[model samples]
Target: TGVASGIAQWENNAFPGDRLDQLDVTNGQVFVQKVDGPVQFFAQLGAYSLPDLGSPYIRSGKATGNFYGAFPQWFVKYAPNDSMSVLAGNLPTLIGAEYTFSFENVNVERGLLWNQENAVNRGVQVNYTTGPLALSFSWNDGFFSNRYSWLWGSATYTINPSNIVAFIGGGSVNTETVSSAVTPLYQNNEQIYNVIYTHTSGPWTLVPYIQYTSVPSDPQLGTAQRASTFGAALLATYALDGGYSVAGRVEYISSTGDANAGAPSLIYGPGSNAWSLTITPTYQKGVFFARGELSYVKATSTTPGFAFGPTGTNTSQTRLLVETGILF
Candidate 1:
């Protein structure tokens, strides 16, 4: 589900120099998921409306990424045997699923550090597992820049059910040398890696994860060249007997990328490294559920124009959110 408010201080700061009233309402989303024997599928469609705050003039538009407010995805998986499985269609990024929970996300929005390059690769991934040993690989049509063809493979070892770790990494070589339509970026080749560790004991689950991505810089956008971000989320969830629970998440984010080299500035050099802590209390009974959350984003970098847009540029921001979801 999504949340909206009458007073939004994030978009375009001072209301983009246009507003018809002192009040507004936001829209949420709806989705459904199911598992039929060996096949599983899920999808969601969300719609939202708010101040179309004018573009705040910045050297680089790193502050926002086309703020087009729609989140939709669907994927289908098939299992023909115990050691083999296949997935086809548009699936969520693997790194995203391993890092954060869908519910209890402090802000309605996700960060910009790397999602900009998280191509919604549409294709297939294969996996095989055998008594503590596993191998997985995938082939996808490049969705990030429309140039790179990403074929990935990985090997895994599972110590135990609750205590497990996977060291996954992949590489994308440029299959098409088309000039970047959005900028002058000619992504020649890139390497990506994910280190995910998950442990679940009784009522608590912990995941200490990291992702490293390297993409080329488009000189036309004043590209901050070769940028990367280091971040972690410590999530603690407590489940109740019935259908109620509370989760707390503390996240720290920092960027190690150039923000001053990209073309015209849409290239998104790293935003100011920041840390945010959020907690969400939720309750659900039957077809109804509600969650109340609060978040605090603290800017650690003094970059002049890099800000989440609370009031001005390059400052801290705090957001309060409440979301309710239902199924029929």
Candidate 2:
């Protein structure tokens, strides 16, 4: 797989080295997997960018080197029976509805709610399927911190051919002070939960999900007060004729805490809230694909010097993105 993209934005949150207009490699990757036998393995090697809403953009080269390295995901699975399997690896996380990479998502840039979730981790996972229900549990490093002190689980049920629901949750078993490009210290120690529903009928697919995350007060962790976030999002896609499709997403998220009490900044800042809307139109044929995205974000109750623009005082931002890629 490969991707190249360009971005144009207003109210750019000029985070020192970031820019208002940029060109970058979105994905340069390959996958290798074997899934037919009792011993199965999957490996993904490449460089990729993690473009996200309300955050500074990191180039693909730096993202690959600073976050998960060149080989982001590789796993070995043992399946002695048809209903159960055990996997050990640098695994994809089960905490959120969105995936880690651009090609795996409906929109080019992730939503505001995704900013509060973990993407990938190093861990062990077990999966089982029975009837219409599927279950997965894992012991992993939360926030890719490599501390190996997090427990995560998910339960999914299929109600019919067109309806499915899932409940997912995860948290750190111990406070981890690790901080890096992939791991934010406060988020690494927080507990997160999600409730998601998916419905598909003919040419339309819809997904709705709600998320909650809480970071407790721990002086040892440099947090003097507890802070939490409540978020909701809806993502939908409509397939049109002649290899065309359109996707849209809307999200709202708010944090709870008093800035005066030394609460950690979660979103724009403590006690801040944000909402976003995104639209993507896509065209794909055979091994090639292209997409264009338009998105807008607005923040309220934000602290000074913590929002958007070069001065970090702007409350709104708009962006346009174009990406062309191939999956071969």
Candidate 3:
């Protein structure tokens, strides 16, 4: 499988390293997977970009080069029976409802809650299913730090045919100091939890989720004080006639601690909070598709030098984006 996509974006309150308008390739990637018998493998290769609300955008070229390289994911799975499987290598994280790539999500950009979750990790995982319950557990490097000191797990329960619920939690067992374009030091050592519910009916799909993350006070880890964030998001999509669909997302996140306590800035600033709304209308025909999105974000109690704009004083931002692509 392969996908190619391009994006044109216009936004206000540009962050320090961001521009007001830009055009770039969003996704040009190939996926290979083999699923049969007792052995299987999956791999994703090439370049891709991750766009999200309330974050500065990175171009596809730099995103691929600086983050996960040309091969973002590659894993081998061994299924010994119908209910048991073991997987190892670079695998996608099970901590969030949204995926890492642009083409795998419902909206053009990810929500605020997605910012606090890990996207991928190198590790070993065990999966098992019995009746209506599916479970998975993994031991991996948190935040791609390559130190392999994190434990993660997820469980999903099917309730009837139209609804499902899932619980996910993960955290680092030891402190990690590695920081890079793909890893944030504080977040790598933090604990995270999520509760998600999904509902589907005739032509509509709805998802609601809540997230919590806590970074403990550890001087050795460079965190002077304990800090945490609580966030909630709702994502919904509706299908219309003639290959048309509409999707929207709403999110709110609030951080704990303040400047007086020297807490790490998890969001806009210590004790700062933010909210965002996004709407995307899409049209698809066969392997071709197009989508336009409008999103707005606002911050409160933001620090003077850590918010938005050229000088980092703006508290609000609005963005317009259009994406066109083909999946083959």
Candidate 4:
């Protein structure tokens, strides 16, 4: 799949702000998969220059020069029996509601909570499935870092084909030299709970989801801190005549945590809340599709940099974005 996009944005007030307008190729990739007997191989390589539209609400890493980027997925899977399988390589993390692929999501930009979660895992995994219940376990390099190790487990229950619930938990620990004479091992733990329901009737389809994440303090730090975030999202799409459709999404996320005194953690800072609404109208014909989206985000926080401006200032911020994309 390949995608090209143009974006325009505006913010009420911000510090170290991002570019307000840009055009780039968001995704250009080819996926190849081969299946033979019980063995399967898959790989996705791509070049992207999409705008950073999620974290901090505005700025992100952008591809430089020509079209060049990193491969997001590559893995191999082997099924030993009807109910068991093994996989190894750089694979997508099993913890999030949104996928790494842009086309697989309902909106052009991912939600606030999704941006903070892990994106990929490099290691091995095992899965077992029976009836409507599936269980999986994995050990991998933490997030995008190979210096740390993480272990994850997930259980999914299917209540019929349209309703499902899943629970995923993972954690990692790393030892770092704090100073010239002392080294402390830091522990990071995370857990996610999710529920999803999909219902389709006539030309209308609706999906409602809820997710929660918890993070405890690192014992190695000078100040112990704990953080948690709870979020919910709803997506709805209505199909129209002549291969046209309208889709919309609404999401809310709230986070709470204490500021760390030493090493940085992945948890959100103290007392922050955000909500967004997006509407996309699209046209699809065969392998070609075009979509236009309008989105708005409003956030509030007591922590300075946590919301808009530098620390100890700026209490709230709002952002609006317009994006258009075409994919083949």
Candidate 5:
């Protein structure tokens, strides 16, 4: 279990318009796991107070308090052999450099790429590992839906003890029909791809990753339009003596095509581009930790600049966050 508290400030009026400068209890979680022979079980239940900074649809409706919300994860795994395993339940998506847990991330807020991608799914996955190569395949509910079906796969290669690379890809299709008509009302398909690389040396670690996704247009709009998004991020961390460390991250994202589509994209609307830089300093001693970060974000649109508020006026913003927590 863990408890974290922090303060955040935004230069311009951002999404969290109500509270621009207020104390927040970012995360409180409980993790339980059991392993016996070839069977394994794990569960994570927590309440998160941080606002959904990037994607509004993710965990947006789960907030019950000013800065408190609940999110849960559970899964079971069975291994029949040393090289193969099967898992079923709610599992974290395996496509991004950052994890769902706050403590596992180098920075306090997720990057543009991480927010655009899917977070978790309920389904079954099979994995196989041999030598320096690992492969996995999964079938799950589409995107964040609980009904539709989607399929995804991943392949990873361990180049050496300190270097590794992975490729993850997935796709899903949805269709609707009316009466006995020969044509369907709408047919939609979505695809996503990601590449991640990690390298570690001594006290320094680096991760560089890229992602692309295509979203289908909505049928209610009565138009066959589509939008696509591309993004990349680089993260680095270095550790110093006496439980001190520093980290930095840089990211870029672009959205093109139909601007009115209901698909998920980066910060701004379609035909928009954004870039950000973040720096963080951290200290850790025993089970206690503290971190401070400063970030700058700038966005440009095809027209009307960037809209961070009720009016499409602001084009850039800066944020500062400081947090401290304990892990026990």
Candidate 6:
């Protein structure tokens, strides 16, 4: 069990105050497992509060959170052995996923490309092992609901073990908006691909990876629609001399154009490109540990434009995020 919190102040971003500042409470969780078995059980719950939590209106809507659920996940796993398994409920998203709760991640925040493209979903997933390869797929409720139908699946393969380790595969995300909450309905989907290379020794490891999102525009928006968007990033981590470790990631994000930019009420951004940086520092000791992270999400402007303002639409908002937590 564990609990922790932090106070983050910012300039020119989202939050409730005379200025951009927020006092937020990060979430917490708990777990219990047997001494030995192919199975274990866990559950998590958290309370997140910040000024100006986005609302169901405005670009991603505008408001404040007495509590913002941080993708809190609960699931059950059955491992017949080490080669195959199945899971249910809110599950672990793969690849870039969300900006938090990544067990092996050292970055305080995730890439904007990841936030705009990859995400954790809830539903059912299967795990399988074949020699040196691992495979997975997911079907869950997506980031949008009611007006849209959602399904997602991803896979990973590990090969070339030695000084150079590698993982390769891809995922496909699908959604359809048939109901009109704001305007003419449409469909959206993407094919995502990523790969990573790593070398490790003792308590240290270094990894670098590349990712891409191929978005196909909606026919409803006509041919002026933007083509697929691709992004690249580099991330590295090192264990230090002070019983601590640090990580940093830089990514350049680009979006062609919204096929659904013409939606009923929601609005997307103006520019086709944006940049994000994530930094994380962590400390650990025996049965207890703590982590701190700072992330900067920026685009070309902050005019408070109301694109993709919910109504069940997808929109990316620029933000400054800081989080600290402890576990025992």
Where model 5 places Cα greater than 4 Å from the true spot, the runs are 1-11, 16-18, 50-71, 175-189, 218-223, 260-266, 302-306
Question: Candidate 3 — which residues are off by over 4 angstroms?
Answer: none
Clashes of 5: 1
Off by over 4 Å in 2: 1-13
- Which has the higher TM-score value, candidate number 4 or candidate number 5? 5
Which window of ten consecutive residues has the lowest lDDT sum in model 1? 51-60
- Model 2 over residues 1-328: C-alpha lDDT tens digits? 4444443343355655678888888888888899898999999988889989889889888999999999899999999999999999999989888999988898989999999999889999999999999999999998889799999899999999899999999899898888998999999999999999999999999999999999999987888899999999999999999999999999999999888898999998899999999999999998788889998999999998889887778898888888888878
Model 4 spans > 4 angstroms off = 1-17, 49-69, 173-189, 219-223, 259-268, 309-328
The best candidate in terms of lDDT: 3
Q: What C-alpha lDDT values do all the predictions have? A: 0.51, 0.90, 0.93, 0.62, 0.69, 0.48
TM values, all candidates: 0.68, 0.97, 0.99, 0.79, 0.85, 0.69
Ranking by lDDT: 3, 2, 5, 4, 1, 6
- Give the best candidate by TM-score: 3
lDDT for each residue of candidate 3 in 242-295, tens digit (9 for 90 to 100): 999999999999999877877898998889999999999999999999999999
lDDT tens digits by residue: candidate 5, 43-66: 876765433333221232244232
* Model 1 TM: 0.68
For 1-328, candidate 6 gives per-residue lDDT tens digits of: 5444443534343333234444544334454433236774445555433222222212111211211233355677777787887787665555552343443346534455554443434667778878766677666544323222344444444545534433433433444543322212222344566666665666666665666655455564343454455566777667887668887777766555542453121113433455566667777766445666665544442124432232313233444545555555
Candidate ordering by TM-score (highest first): 3, 2, 5, 4, 6, 1
Deviation from native of the Cα of residue 297 in model 3, angstroms: 0.6
**Shift of residue 138 alpha carbon in model 5, Å:** 1.3
Model 1 C-alpha lDDT per residue in residues 168-278, reported as the tens digit of each score? 666565434434322223222445676767788887767666666555554443344755455565656677777877776666655565445441222222544566566
What TM value does model 2 have? 0.97
Lowest summed lDDT across 10 adjacent residues in model 2 is found at: 2-11
Ten consecutive residues with minimal summed lDDT in candidate 5? Answer: 179-188
Question: Could you give the C-alpha RMSD of every candidate to the true structure, in order shown?
Answer: 6.6, 1.5, 0.8, 5.0, 5.4, 6.5
